[model samples]
Target chain A: MSSEPRIFDPDEHDDVHLETELPEAELSDEAWETAALPDDLLLLGDQLRCDATRLHESHRADRLQHELLRPERAQRAETLVPARGISAWLPLLWLLPVVLITAALVSNGQPTVPRIPASPAVAVTPSVTPQAEYSPQVYSVSLPAETPSQHGPSAAELDALLDLMQNETASVAVSL
Target chain B: MKICGLDVEKLTSLYFDRIHRAALLMSGNAWDADDLAQEVFLIVANDPTKFEGRSSHYTYLYGILLNLERRLRRKRRMHQEKTEKLAQRQDGPTAAVAADVPVVSEEWKRSLWSVAAELPDGQRQAIVLRFGEELPYQEIADILGCPLGTVKSRIFHGLGTLRKLVAESPGQLREIPRELGDAQSDVI
Candidate 1:
C-alpha cells in the first residue's frame, strides 16, 4: 500500500538544462532584496518581512482534524442552503393569497360580479322668490320763486354810520 | 489518515506550517487560508491517486492549495458580483491580524499582501513559493510546473508588480489588476 510519489530527480528532467540556459529568469532571495527600491518601498519590504517572520515562527494544523472528520455533504448542506427564512416560506407565501381568496369565496357562497350601485340622481331646485322690479323714480329740481337776493348794507341800513357821515359833526367821535 | 502510501496525516503534521503560511500569503485572511489549507488536504485524502510519485510532496500539496485558492478567489468574485447590490458588499479576505507585526506596519503589510493576492496565477505561485514559503528557485519551479528560469522570470515580474503596487498604494485597498486578475479564473 506504499504508493509514495517518486521523488523528482533533476537528472531525469530537461528543466535542469533549461535552468542554466535562462539565468535571467531566476531571482534569489538575496538578489530580490538587493534589487533597488525607493526608500518608502524599502521600509515597506522590511515591514512585510516582519509579517512573514511572524507567520514563519508559528504553525498548527488547526482545522485538519475537523476537515477530515466532517462529512462533505454536511458542509455543503450548511452553505448550499437554497432556502432559508423567507425563501423556505416563499412557496407557501405565493399560495397564501389564493388560498385565502378561495376560502372566502367558498364561505361567502358563489362568486358574484359585484353590481355597480346607480350613481345618486342629482336633484334640481327652482329659486322660489322672483326678482323684484327695480325702477328708479325720476327726480325733479325747482328754483324758489325768488331766491332771496342777498343785499349789501345801505346807508339807511347803517343808520348810525350814515348819520355820522351826514352830520360830519362827530367826525372825531364816529370814525366811519 | 494513511491512504495508500500517502500518509496524509503525517504529511499534514509535516508541512502544515508551510502550506498554511502559503495559504495565508495567497489569501490575506487567516480564516480563508485555514479553510484553503484544510481543503487541500481533504482533496488529496479523497483522491490519493491524483498525486502520483512525480514531484516533491510539498509541491503536490502547494499545487492543490493554489488550485483551491484560485477557485475560492473566483467563487468569491462571482459571489461578489451576484450580491454586489445587496445593500452590503460581500465579505472579502480580511486578515486584520494576519501577523503579529507592528501596528504601524500592519496597514502596509496588509496592503502588500492583498496586492500580492491579486497577482496572476503563475506569477503569484512563483512569488509565494519564493518569498512566502522561502522555497528555493528549483523548488518553486517544481511546484509551479515551470523551468527554473521561467520561475525566476515570474518571480522577477511578480515582485516588480508588488514593489510598484506597494510603492504607489501602500495603505489603501488597491484595485485588482484587470488584465491579469481574471486570467486564471478558469484555472481550477
Candidate 2:
C-alpha cells in the first residue's frame, strides 16, 4: 500500500521495477510468435491454392464453353389452324379472287363485270347521265336485246316502257 | 489506336485484379466481390479504346471502382437498413443485435472477425481495407469513398475496440506490440 516512488540511487544493486506497470502475462522474455509456416508447407499451400483457383477457373471456363456451344433452339413458324369449317375458306376463296381480279384489272386498265342495280330489273331508269339507283357503273354493261327481252319486259310493254323512259330522260335533263 | 494499347490492356488487367481484391476484402465474401468486380470492369472495358492514357490506368480504374463501390455499398446499406428497420418495428433493440452477427465461431480469427463485424459498417470496411488488405490510408479512403481523416478515424477506433475486447478476455493483457498497443492506448 506504500505510495513512495522506488529509489535507484548510487550503490543500489536492487533490480529495476519492471513488474510495477507491466502486466504479468506480457512480461515474459519470449515474444508471442505466429506459428512459423514450414517451407514445404508453404509451398504446398501455395500449390493447393493455385490448383483450387485453376479448378475454379476451369469450371467457369467449362460453363462458358458449354453455353457458347449449346445449340440454340430453332424458331419454328407457327402454323395457324382455323377453328371454323369450310365457311372460312369460302370467304377467303371468294374475296381473294375478287380482290386479285380487281387489282389486276385496275393495273391493266381493264374493267370487271358491272354490278347490277338494286331495282326490279324492269323499271330501268332512262337518265342520259346514267342515274343508277344503286351503282354508278352498273348500267354501262349494255345488255343484248335478246337477253333484255328474255329477262326484261314483254314487247307490248316495251313501247309503253320506251315512252316512259323518254319522258324520264327529258325530266332528268331539265332538272340538270 | 489509343495509348500503348497492349500495355494499357495489361495495366487494365492489373487494375481489375487490384480493384477486385480490394472489393473482396471490403465485402468479406467472394460472390458479392466477383459481381462488384464484374460491374467495375464493365464500366472500364466500355470504350477501352477511348482511354487516352493521360493518367495511370490503375488510377482511372480505381476511380471508377470507387464510384461503383460507393453506389453498391449504398444500395446494400439501404437493403440492410430496411431489414433492420423492419426488424426493429417487430422486435425493438434485439433486432439490432440480431442483425449484427450472422455467424458464430470460437476461433481467434472468428472472434476478431465478429468484433470487426460488429463495428459500424464504415469502420468495418476501413479496417478490412487497412488491416485485412494492408492498404495505405489514402488508398483505403479512396476505396471506401471517404475522406482521409474519416479513414484514419475508423481504423483507429476499430483497432481500439478490438484491443479492448482482447484485453477483457482470460488473464492479464499479453505483449501486444508497442506500436499497436500505443494506438489502442492513445484512443482510450
Question: Highest lDDT, which number?
Answer: 1
Tens digits of per-residue lDDT for model 2, B1-188: 23446554565566666676655544545565677778766765565665566655655665665566667667866777787877777876665645654232223122244345456667666765554444565565555565554565565466556555545544432233323342322211
Clashing pairs in 1: A5-B53, A6-B53, A25-B152, A25-B153, A26-B152
Q: Report model 2's TM-score to 2 decimal places.
A: 0.36
Angstrom error at residue B126, model 1: 1.3
List candidate 1 stretches off by more than 4 Å: A1-20, A24-47, A55-176, B1-6, B85-111, B170-188
lDDT of each: 0.64, 0.52
Highest TM-score, which number? 1
Residues A1-176, candidate 2: write the lDDT tens digits: 99999886654432222212223223221110012222332222233234334433543565587677665422122134434455646767768878988899796785566768797658778768755566555556766676433655567777776788877866422221
Model 1, B113-148: lDDT tens digits are 667666788877776776667687778777777666
Which numbered prediction scores highest in DockQ against the true structure?
Answer: 1
